[model samples]
Target chain A: MSCDHLDLALASGLDLLGPDEAREFALHLPGCPACRAEVETSRLLLDALAFSAAAPAPRPALRRAILRRAQASRWRLPGPVAAVLLVALFCAALWLGATRFPVLPAVTRTASGYIIASLDPTARSPHAKGEVMLLPEAGHILVMADGLAPLRAGRVYEAWLLTRGGAHALGPLHLDGWGYAWLHARVPPGAFRGLLVSVEPARPGPGPSGSTVLATSGDAK
Target chain B: MQEADLPRRLARGDARALAELYDRFAPGVFSLALRRLEDAGAAEEVVQDVFFKIWHGRALFDATRGDLPAWIFAIARNTVYDQLRRRLRQSRLSEAQAAMLDLFATSGFEALEHLMAQEHIAELLAALTPEQRDLVRLVCVDGRTVAEAASLLSTPLGTAKSRLRAALARLRQTLATEVRAQ
Candidate 1:
């Protein structure tokens, strides 16, 4: 037996229904076994179709990077503590103004041991731009970026310190409505090659897993 | 490690389990992304995003509800859709068209117990008439709506819809027979 929702079932199985239509179909699915079977069969077909695509092996480095990130995730602080620390650091930054930490416009080394690096956009995000400021003596790194394309839900921009070993997660770069974000983090003791910002899932991973939005030349390497 | 034990190991924060999961599914995830995005770099990003979610969100996986591979592929599918949506937005497509693209967005589904191998799937696709194949490609592979596929193929909307329905039914019946034979 057929019902009025047959077309809706087909479209839903193909993932061609909008949110509203899909929801309506979903509500009707439990009561209608015919529509349910149609949806299941269509999904099965699509799943088979998905496997038809060519499967090229990913680069080995990508695998290593993911593993390293997974390992580092073990050391991450709990959410509440991290948030409190971030707030304290932001308050500290406000207290120490231009006199203590003067903003440098170009890639220059100030006598106060502040090293600045420019972050250029990658092909993935051409219009995005950023700057990195490093104060090694004080063990602080400041990242400022703008012109970023807004990410979809459950995604965010994250900063990482690139080293000879692997990437070290800085933290999430919280962006305002204008696609501007600034992150302040203590520079971990290590020989750093450069820094980069990547688009990552909302649940932060230890390494750069998403597309590189902004990066130093060295970091891109 | 047994496939059935993966979810448990991953939830216990076993790094080896994550690596094993990646080894099993990375190629399929990359292939799906590369097919949809057609850019190697972007496809790699999708691979990373998929694994990252699988690793970090392991606790959310309930083996009672679905198997691990199905859950993994669901994440892969959703991530690819996100990439597509981002591309549509960046291209400055009109709001109406963007809304239409939303129709293709999925909230994940339970995957089949076994997907046909690439060669087998290709062979099955080859069994379809050329017109039916093109219609499937336009809507399923190219992410086009039925109306859009109809317009592009110079066919009536109702005809295109019927062709798609027929194509899916044929494939499903063939696949079910193959499964039973196994």
Candidate 2:
């Protein structure tokens, strides 16, 4: 194939080429320096791009709309209209409120894929700190501490990665309140396996430092 | 995801699909925009606009038109080009000032490309507007930060940021094209 045709063929969908066109494009690769270089570079870039690694973005709105449209997804009653239902619900609510009702059941959100854990504890009498919130796909993992004594300003609560073998210092998480200290950890491959928080100096290294303030052990959950 | 499946979800106005698509390419896209626009604000605005359009376009996308990434990239490229044309027509920036805006606007992924390219970063300098060429000489060649470059140019920080981002994204795309041509 000529260089122009060869280039056009390469950019066009790979599936569309007949055997001859595909073969002709490959033949041009051997003799043409510019085209050969172009082919190799494009291949490398596309390879590195990991195009197939893309995952489907969850369509929450679509799910909601689908559920709304599909009548089986929700229960609906047609009869005595909204006024009667509102009055009945209001009466029930009032009766419950007047009788010194028990506290309402805790409504908590369920999260997908948690880091589950069980850990070894030192016999030394000490309280372990705990915190939780949504984490992004990247950046420093923010671990926090709360309801604890004020740590020295320069001092931070360092987080640690625990293995059956030993411990690695994650990093010092900045402390905000007795109820809040953030352990900023660089997420490494499998680093999220098990985490321990330590109150180390404002500067902490790759291994655990100072005392363990809050600790958690988790398996993939 | 199966090409057939996305349209159905999108038709229902599923925002999560938009998020998923963003997750797949947004970093590179944003980084590309940042490289061109230099200012994070402009680059971010472009990225957000692209996704917002996709989110609102739930029922509009057709599976047979093209692959999503290339389509998205084309839209992004057009958006950047439109911004450049709009700024040039509206602002009347001087040649010296415009040069500084494009120079040093790139950071995040040019750094990554450098790491991956085995020291062969291709001819980035040759790909520039004359004004951008001057900015390269003054800031990058002289090691000036955005603040330093802005002070030297006697321009507002906002203008500098926008120009820098636009320039960087252009340079990065140019380099990407050149690298592909290798």
* Leading candidate by DockQ: 1
RMSD of each: 16.7, 25.0
lDDT of 2 at A170: 49
Q: What lDDT tens digits, residue by residue, belong to model 1 across residues B10-111?
A: 977788999998887788778777655767898898887677666555544556644566566555655665555556737854543343334333211232
DockQ of every candidate structure: 0.16, 0.02
Give lDDT tens digits, candidate 2, residues B76-176. 44344334433553575444224323321211122122223212222454566666554544443333466677778787766665555455445546655
In the range A1-221, model 2's lDDT, one tens digit per residue, is: 23575343223111223468667765664466555444433322322222222222224453343233322211222224323543453343233222211111111111211121222222221433343221212212334343455665687665565433356554455433223344323333233434566666666765675666555532111
Restricted to chain B, the TM-score per model reads 0.60, 0.49
Query: Candidate 1, which segments miss by more than 4 Å at Cα?
Result: A1-44, A51-54, A77-221, B92-100, B105-168, B174-182
Question: For candidate 1, lDDT tens digit of each residue in A97-202?
Answer: 2222333232334222445566778899887766665655445666767678888999988888765556767778755343456665655433345788999998
